[model samples]
Target chain A: MTLKEIKELLQAEVICGDHHLGTEIILAGGSDLMSDVLAFGKPGLLLLTGLTNLQSVRTADIIEAKAIIYVRGKKPDDQTIKLAAEKNIPLLSTPLMMYEACGLLYQAGIPGVSPANNSNKAND
Target chain B: MTRDDEFRQTFKIKGRDFSHAGGVSTEIKEILQEIGIPTQLIRRVAIASYEAEMNVVMYAQQGKLILSINPETIQIEVEDKGQGIKDIELAMQEGYSTATEEMREMGFGAGMGLPNIKKNSHVFLITSTPGVGTYLKMIFYLDHEKAS
Candidate 1:
């Protein structure tokens, strides 16, 4: 799915990267653990999370994620926004809670990842 | 841009301020990148740097992280002035942490900090006193000949 679809489906606000809504995302996952996201995320996946710290943006930076969706209407602070701008990471905020956000994205055809096998690959 | 005689940069960290927690690690990452460190090495340093960064921020009231880089090795030292770990052996175990709810909510303090650092680094050490403080060090050895 594309960022455009995610914005529409989750009813999210595009806090940054409005011009890049056309960027396509292959897979997505929802988790509160930034370490797990960094530890488990696939190369091509988008991250949906409730933890909207600057570290969250930094975690997205490490993995080079497509975008980040802040569920439950959490808008990032100025520092986080500035970092997102610096990193060129697309950031969004949604009123939908974490579970619903994941469900909508999944229903929209974006699926969660199985990191057990991926962890082995990361180890290798 | 210039490092100490043997080490690259030695920074003093003040813990629990929360705002400046990740600053030292970010700087170290930038320097290593500028010096043309390899991706695997860079990522390894980042993981260790970040773990060490969070440890000082959340666990200690005050601490310092030092970064030293040379042709052969990259070394990081973190010293903290918090209440030291009660059981070093158990704390080394995965899925163990003394992190508060606020810290955990931020997605760190997952009990993987030490383990991740140990995994990424070639050599690791941790020493702590219950009333005094804690000192941690990690070294990543690089064969410059092989890398070049």
Candidate 2:
């Protein structure tokens, strides 16, 4: 699905990179831990996270995430926004919690980073 | 620049500087991109480099990240002055961590940093002294056939 469709479906607000909404995002992964994201995230992965900090944006850029959606109505500070814009990684926020946001996206056919392998279990 | 030409640069990292923690890694990524490293390989380098930088910011007083590139390989060396790992074997485990709540709040500290670095690099080495510091050397081969 395109990021524009995700914005509409989740009723999210674009915090940065408004011009990037047309980008395609077929896979996503949610985590507040940047370590897990780095370990599991693939190129062009859409990151769903609740951590509203500069690291989130940095992690997205490091892993080559297409975009980020901050859940639970959380938003990052100005520095974070600036970094996101600089990296060309779009940032969005939704009022829904992490669970609901993941469910909605899953229901909409956007799969997690590794749906079949369950690589996250190794971290558990 | 040709593959045979060597490139080397060093970036300093300040501990507890959450505001600018990952900047060096991002800069490293940009440098690799400009040098025309493969996207997949660049991603691996970026991930490993970011995790190493974060380790310095979270645990050390200060550190230096050195990037070296040659015809055959890309190498990163991170050396930090701070409380070093007491048990390297335990720290290498998948889920072992000694991160504080503040570290976790910043979206890291789940103990995957070193392991993730090792996973992404074709050759990895780590050495530390409990009271002194830690040093990590990671190398990625330019020839994709030798990467695994």
Name the candidate that leads on TM-score. 2
Task: List the per-model TM-score of the A chain.
Answer: 0.90, 0.92
Which one wins on DockQ?
2
Cα RMSD (Å) between model 1 and the true structure? 3.8
lDDT tens string, model 1, A1-124?
6899889999999999898799988778788886667556655568898888788887776666789999999988888888888878999999999999988877766666765534232223
Off by over 4 Å in 2: A115-124, B1-4
- lDDT winner: 2
Question: Interface-residue RMSD per candidate?
Answer: 1.8, 0.5
* lDDT at position B52, candidate 1: 81
**TM-score computed on alpha carbons, candidate 2:** 0.94
